[model samples]
Target: MKKNGNREEFNREKLLKGIVRSAEKRPVSMDAITNLVDRVENKLRSLGENEVSSQQIGEYVMEDLVNLDEIAYIRFASVYRQFKDMSVFYKELKEIMEKDKKKNQDQDHSGDK
Candidate 1:
């Protein structure tokens, strides 16, 4: 269901198109975007629920996008999350950066051994 409480069928093509729009002009490839869509669809199906909310789908998208492409993630986030102000948007960016920094640090240490 949407935030407006309207129920609709989940469209894989629609999801793919939105990701494409967000990832446009970026280094992200169609293969990566398609895999993200496939993963999200698989996750939703695994839920075994009759219906899922748009918010849930958005979260799923963000989860994968964050790892796929930061710019596209931010773009998708600004729309999916509807940031009310710059502060909120900045906060989100900071969080993503922090996560990325930690990920890099972990990889660095793993290679040190």
Candidate 2:
């Protein structure tokens, strides 16, 4: 068990190192980087809110910081929201999934019905 924990930590460290190298090679612009970080932060922070700002979302995407996109965002948001019960957590998950599916479905259609 301890060995597995060590392995996981090592893997995380290696992944972080790779991200740092990539960051160093082509430094992300401050404006873009700030936006992405903000998205990741806000997406993880806010809950019970109906809308997220477009500029903030764009900033997060431009920075390439939200690598996990919806999953990571959802995980982070769940913890941040402090879910009172499994039901609440699952409800949030379903809402997010439904929203994503609806978005994809809309994209498939050329025009509004």
Candidate 3:
């Protein structure tokens, strides 16, 4: 079992629940979610620590979801980051857009003959 900063036993079920909720109405499959959970568990083991922060776990989830589904990634991020207001939400969305834009630009430049 993992422990959070608060020194409480981390609930793995809660992690799965959050992923499930984020994937709701999205194209993410149950198999993918299961695989993600396994990956996160492996990550925790790889850390070889007695306790791990919720923030760290959330980061791993966000990284996995970002590649699995953008919508699900945003959904999980909004909740995990606990956005205080629309401004925060907007900022996150803008950052994601900018990252995608830059990635596309780099790809386009690389493809140029």
Best by the lDDT measure: 1
Best by TM-score: 1
lDDT of 2 by residue, 1-66 (tens): 122232111132333333333344344444544455555555535644444443443344423543
Question: TM-scores, in order shown?
Answer: 0.94, 0.42, 0.84
The local distance difference test score of model 1 is 0.95
Total backbone collisions for each predicted model:
0, 3, 0
lDDT of candidate model 2 versus the reference: 0.49
Model 1 agreement with the true structure over 1-113: per-residue lDDT tens digits: 99999999999998899899999999999999999999999999999999999899999999999889999999999988999999999999999989989999999899788
Runs of candidate 2 with Cα error greater than 4 angstroms are: 1-34, 38-68, 111-113
C-alpha local distance difference test of each model: 0.95, 0.49, 0.87
Error of 3 at 86 (Å): 1.6
User: Model 2 clash pairs?
Assistant: 35-59, 36-59, 36-60
lDDT of 3 by residue, 1-113 (tens): 22333666767788899999999999888999999999999999999998888888999999888878889999999988989999999998898889889989999999786
Among all windows of 10 consecutive residues in model 1, the one with the lowest summed lDDT is: 104-113
Off by more than 4 A, model 3? 1-5
